[model samples]
Target: MPPRTSLPRRAAKSPALRKIAVVLALVLAYQLWLVVQAQGKVGPGVGAQRDARGRFAVDVELGFAPERFHILRLQKHGRIAGTDGHVVHLRGVAPAGVDALAREYWIRHIEVPRRGS
Candidate 1:
């Protein structure tokens, strides 16, 4: 004889759930569209420059290409580190109080780290 087994039960599907799912999907799609549009071009809200001490201060859009300045990493708390072993900060502009993220940035005279994410 074979041993008996029972499968776990799942909640019954509801029309409300389906509607919610559809709405969420649509909202997500819209957000993705915005991101794609932003990626196509850097907005006026975007910019990057070195300070008097050769440190960096930036207020670039999320999709801003880091390849132009070779920015290695945008650290937490507005600190951005470059490939030159020096840390910089973004001045005059931030993501409107939102935390800044380290994305693709380009610059010159810098060394990129070879390991780790």
Candidate 2:
């Protein structure tokens, strides 16, 4: 009769542990992708600028009508000094840059004025 041989407990669990590690790595990669996507959405705009007054000059797009009310909420940061069609021009103290306004609703894009302009 042949003698029976049992696998070591750690060796038996190796495959399961490897599977868990792979899943965790995949999840981490997916989370990183999501962060990149969000950051791209709020990337600094071309119209962003800093004037002699120390205020940031920005062009904000308040998507479609009715939802335009969101512009009012932005007044808390600073007033909408002007508008050309649907795009609202803003001059404010944006210490964090244009991306700081990304959290506001209906704000599709914030175009920052170019430097030295």
Q: Residues 7-75, candidate 1: write the lDDT tens digits.
A: 322212566667887999999997676555444333332333434554334533333345434343444
Task: For candidate 2, write residues 1-117 as lDDT tens digits.
Answer: 986556665654688887988999999997676545445444454434556766666766766642455566666666677676667667774655454565554467666643432
Q: Per-prediction count of colliding residue pairs?
A: 10, 7
The count of residue-pair clashes in candidate 1 stands at: 10
- Per-candidate Cα lDDT values, in order, are 0.39, 0.61
Top model by lDDT, which number?
A: 2
Best by TM-score: 2
lDDT for 101 in candidate 2 is 66
